[model samples]
Target: MTTLPVRPVTDVPARPQPAAPRREHRLRSLDGLRLVAALMVAVYHYAGRGGEVARAWGTSPAEQFPTLHSYAAYGCLGVQVFFVISGFVICMSGWGRSLTSFFASRASRLLPAYWAAVVLVTAVFALPVVAYEAVSPSDALLNLTMLQMPLGVDRVLGVCWTLWAEVRFYALFALCVVLPGVNRRRVILFCAGWTLAAALTRSVHEPLLDLVLMPEYAPFFIGGVGLHLLHRDRRDGYGWGIVAVSFLIGQHYAVRDLWNAADPHAFAHRTSGGIVLVVAFAFVAVGAIALGLLNGVNWRWLTTAGALTYPFYLVHEHLGWPAIQLLHRTWGLPSYATLPLTVAAMLILARLVHGWVEKPLTPRLRGVLNKAR
Candidate 1:
């Protein structure tokens, strides 16, 4: 949702006179892809899984949206798609930035809408508008810090779990690559080392290693970095190798998640082969974007659509469910009508959060952070 600034050229030729900086082209297509990924996740939560809505409506959503439910089940893979995009975007944006500036950029980009959503969701849960679980004040406070997962506290919004994973990726990236200064060699090594560490995670007993390595999600991010390398410089053999290996490792984890899904009822009917295929598609899609295959897609409206993606993802699950419950059950609206209405309302809410919360706060937060620095 927060597209990092275009990256600086890493392969500029030497000249006696100082050369002007040439920023990489902004991949607006990636922004459009982000919105698609967000929508996929949203659809998955609302229609794919029958559990949450089934409890509220006394009927299965799968049965309600018979045609859409099967396809929607695979929408959960949108997270992996996001990670791949993140790897490419983060690496691109972080290339020429300072560590302090990087932190400031990330904090500014993430926190405002996140803080607003935490409070909004907390307030929603506190009210009797829906039968959803209420988040306590303490949990709300911890969530504001965005460190609730490691703090052993519950998330204010269940979707914030991905934020934690992203945070870990940022920390690891900053420490290993950004802090040391981003370059072709260091980035390649970072991806390579990360791939190896993730591969070995299943054989290791160290909790911290597994936690930091995030073996299940590592390949997507690693593959993303590899993709960025290709984007930055097309003749990167090591980058291609990294992408290939990461996809292989990432596919294994994706299939594993399908089989060992926490909510077996939601994914029980899904096949490992389907999961593998979907994950492979995500990688391929991202790879195509990185290689500039979609350069011709410069639809200006996608910029606005992309801007709403982050907040859309944040509020869609916890908040949308209640809206669905209220509309379908309380107002006697049918699933056909309720699903689209809820999604539209959530998108509008996301736009509001983006405009009122994120746009206004990001600059101020960045200024404050920069001043502190």
Candidate 2:
């Protein structure tokens, strides 16, 4: 807020200056990284689901091409990256805000885009899959709340599973906001508890805890929060330690995944350490972000890419899988080419939703919500 070079000279008093606009912190590199993460997941779903379908129908070959096999196997790791990012972003968002403000921010950012994505996905997937599976309108509508899993109902779209983890993370973090004396130190302790639970999550059979803790992925969420704290106070080694513990635990999961993978060809390349590479990349990326090495990633293009991420993730597989089957059957296109083409189509659809649906509706929705208060 720079003062005026010269104040107006008058017999009467001058009016007060208006407050400066608040500076919103935007991470550009993370945005770019988001697109990368989304692409990784897309590759995983495209090739991986194809393999699953083939195996289910007993049409899949024992061997696959080098690139597709590796990507299909390891691509699932991208969701862990999303989790880390979600923790960091959620923590960053809660700073210096009241609980109400925090919830409003989260809701405004999520619900509109999510609702639109739900409709888009349902239109693409549910109506088509009814031929094979029993999908009632009640079960499909349950996904609108994003609590289908917790309610013991199946998800309308497969991708909705990860969102259930995110919703639980949000709810847990909200406790920190509303409770007294739950500052950074307590948050760090909470991360430790979550990490420990990852090791011995006895509540797996417990319905609510199963949805809330999601023990296998809790480490990623806790690690992201740890990174947020690390970024907040660089001198805090405790934050670093928590992040390290989470990474080690995540590495363990990756190793387990590699060994248990039904398809041996995903590890054929052998350079990336197979599924371990995604977690490794996440470890490095989050650390780099926390250390502020990626301050330069604040480009507008990166911001745009980041903006495209959520909608793209929500709708990609919903659109891609059916399109993949359709193209293979009707046009006789190869799976590899069909995958990229369908991915491209999904990207276009994402851009449409972002531009025409989300961007236009979000502000109006927020304005309405604000005014109603």
Candidate 3:
């Protein structure tokens, strides 16, 4: 048997499969960041009222308050940060999931709480004590559907305008993800093209389409998506560097033209300023990802606060206004005192609502949704 001397079977150790890149789940830092953004928005609105009071009182004190006014300016930027975060987080959470499941999850998560807030706000507006003029049934229905923005109808829940924008963003993203032949590359290109077109059109003061329909804010979302893609793939460092530079440039321009402007409205003169702010926001989104801040250290308290933020955001504006009015009428608290007090009250109430209402209700609602499905 010319069987070649059977080579001693060499036992080759199977190469250990590379440990699946540690799949990170909880991102405590992002929760903390969300808390910071939410607080900024709350403080902004509170301080904004103070500015109005100062103006009405014809006192230089309001303008000189420095801290309050500074917060107000910075607070406006919070919304931009929110948009970026929304794009990044939502996309990351839902990527690769089926569109149906994604939409169902989103509907379950968002609609119950959102509808509750809307009804509560509307009911308050209907009450004799707080009675503002009732919205027409048509307007109310439109708002409920969250289609008011696309239709160019007036917003029923004033603070909810951003929610409409967010809804649209989600819808577009779902379409991109679910449609046949739509891959990550195509989605990226589509988003980039859409954003560039929107920015270019807006810069020229041409309305190619209504803000709601055209996705004028797509760039911020795309920037977020881009960051996610870059980070997930372990691409070259240049992308991160570019994102950082873009952020700094955007922030510099915002501070110089918008923050430092003697007349806040003057910054609005150069419509390009808004574009710059969007760019800056995108930068922050990428930086958060690259620095791992969003997915890094977990702070339970802040995470809890972040969980309550959406409801707080919705309720605080209306609640603060009334609380301020009550204090002004009864105690005649000075603007400085009243502003901080109103903010504190709103925060307290938000925590209560989150714990007592939203937290409890969310799970039950989700269960119902799952059963229905």
Candidate 4:
């Protein structure tokens, strides 16, 4: 028998492993980009086709502001930029949080200002304000839930449709990825799965599925998720692949819907090449930020600008249209003057909402949600 030497164990305990440093979540440049996107939409709504939506200029907007309209015509594509940023921001924020936490965060962020805007717009419309279609009381109540669109109620504000889109994205992301716990693999799967579902559902006449998948806007959001992966892991080939594929699919849809033949809006008649270029630039911009190209962008003002974007976007159109109508039709301001002034006023109001509503309400709402959970 081989002699077995008895080994003596030491009394020392094992050392604790060091925790990883948390990545800083804030991207100041992206805040600036958010402001840019909000401003783009504002410009498009106010000046695109010469304020045709409001018809406040008393003449054809396309003809009244031909120079400005030429460029602002593509500003509607800012919505695509917004969806892409939402993807990146949502994934970045949702990572490592519980599903309840995610829900609370989104609700807190979206609802306070949304509620205020709904009330404000409804009240303004109820009065003899600018002659836009008045939202009914029942519709206003549904709008408060942000479920007006799916419930077959008219939107209190046309821009509310985008909020519904965002809510759907959040729902899908929460259930599929966040509920199970967010990880690189899960996010990749979510992106791929959503893309496929969106594609398949495009031809299927299922209203519910179409609403959930949002086929027209899915690529931008998916690409944002992929880009966030790259941001987190540092230069991932798989992430780049996802972004590339998303761009291709998204580009095709953008051209088809906005330019080629699918209910082509009169203002969306830009050269297909131009639309492709703008969409390409949007992807490249977000991708660059993800890859840390914008890391050194530490401008503090971008923070304030970013905070104002949501309320600015929320209140801009419905409120500003009336302002535009009054200033142009009643006060005799020129289109150029009226547009800028209206935007300035909206921005000021956004700052106020950010300060009075969002800043105060978000934390309280979040606290309530946390306790309920």
Q: Stretches of candidate 2 above 4 Å error? A: 1-24, 50-67, 125-134, 178-182, 197-200, 203-208, 261-273, 367-373
lDDT string for model 4 (1-373, tens) is 8999776667457789855434566899899889888999998887775443547667766766878777887888899999999999999988888888999999999999999899888988788645876778988988899888778898887798889889989999999999998888899999999999999997887978887898889999999999899888766878888899999999999988778334455654577888899899789889889988998988899999999999999999888878888888899998889889999999999999999999999999998997887
Candidate 4 worst ten-residue window by lDDT: 260-269
lDDT of each: 0.87, 0.72, 0.61, 0.86
Model 1: per-residue Cα lDDT over 243-336, one tens digit each: 9899898988888776545555553366788888888878888888888899998889888888999999999988887888888889999888
RMSD of each predicted structure: 8.9, 6.8, 5.9, 3.4
Q: How many clashing residue pairs appear in each of the predictions shown?
A: 0, 2, 0, 1
Which tens-of-lDDT digit does each residue in 52-146 have in candidate 2? 44432234422434456655656778898999888888877776555666667677778777888777666655464422343467887887887
Estimate the overall C-alpha local distance difference test score of candidate 4.
0.86
Query: For model 2, what is the error of residue 173's alpha carbon versus the real structure, in angstroms, after optimal superposition?
Result: 0.5
lDDT of model number 1: 0.87
* CA displacement after TM-score superposition, residue 322 of candidate 3 (Å): 0.2
What TM-score do all the candidates reach, one by one?
Answer: 0.92, 0.81, 0.74, 0.92
How far does residue 311 in candidate 2 sit from its true spot (Å)? Answer: 0.9
